[model samples]
Target: MTGWIESDRWAERARELRDEGWMLMDLCGLDRSGLGRSVVNAGGAGTAGAGFRNAEGTGGLYGPRFEVVVQLLHALKKERMTLHVNAAGDPPTVPSVVEVWPTANFLEREAFDMFGIQFEGHPHLTRILMPDDWEGHPLRKDYGVGKVPVEFISQPLMQIDSPGQSPETVAAERSVDELGQSGPPLRTVEEG
Candidate 1:
């Protein structure tokens, strides 16, 4: 099951669950900046995952810009729980659960690397995936989608100048541009 909790009560609730035999499995960040985007169609055909609703069920985009999602597991009982905590302000932040689970060190670092969600009280919070000089959080929805183009090198076919020797003497020779195209001439001793 999943439950959304306030940001201020995040560490408090996490501690409660830990005492109840819950172990932190993973923690990640979310960018809900443009949740209003149409999930069904880009042109806004239907409303499924878009639009923000307040605690009172009123509709608006006034929700927090970022959120932290955590997965918890009960070791012996074999049960799971999902917890969500909001992170607000110009630079969103949440209390680190590293104290509760040492494994959260890497998870919270990854969240910070990808989404720029600060984990307060973390021993050494730094970029875990991206380089230290990286410009912005790549996983955020507001980040621009950049792409690099690839180019292919064309190779010409080799030729066997020896007469009486079949064209297949070179064992599957072909040109990169087109089959049987002229390429670098390979002179044979038999021709001399």
Candidate 2:
């Protein structure tokens, strides 16, 4: 089962589902800014819009720029449910389910780190994958693509003087026979 819940009622609905024995399976964010080229229908069929509609039946041509998807599972009943909550505003904001599900802490942080979707009431909403100094969310459609030079740790170069130690110096002072052929020797069919 799948349903779209309003952003304001996100936490409340999540709590209700939790109380009903639904286990929070996964939580992630989506950036709908690029949906103009490809359409995504969240509310299944019968909707008149290109995107999905919330529980209150509110949705536009493309809905909100950001949305949070929550997956829940009822283990004993063998049932699964997907919930979509639209995040609105300059920095898309959605109610955090971390309080209801402790596992949501890292998932919500990742959404914030990659898509810049702010999870309101998140106890510690910090960057999980990117460095603290990262300027913008890399997964957002509007974020600029820029190259970042990777600085590797400096290490002392080892001096390899023995033959075969390096590819450039392989068998430098030895004949092919001295090197010795690797693997089993080739035999004719008659020998076998």
lDDT per residue (tens digit) for residues 86-134 in model 2: 8988788998989999999999999999999999899999999999988
**Could you tell me how far off, in angstroms, the CA of residue 69 lies in candidate 1 after the best superposition?**
0.6
Against the hidden reference, what TM-scores do the models get? 0.64, 0.65
- At residue 65, candidate 2 shows an lDDT of 75
lDDT of 2: 0.74
- Please give, for residues 8-115, the per-residue lDDT of candidate 1 as tens digits: 788888889889999988888878767653111121212243443443542332357788888888878877776667787767889898998899999999999999
Model 2 segments beyond 4 Å from truth?
37-39, 42-62, 144-192
Give lDDT: candidate 2, residue 112: 96
Query: Candidate 1, which segments miss by more than 4 Å at Cα?
Result: 37-55, 58-62, 147-192
lDDT of each: 0.73, 0.74
**Winner by TM-score:** 2
Residue 10 local lDDT, model 1: 86
Residue 50, candidate 1: C-alpha displacement in angstroms: 13
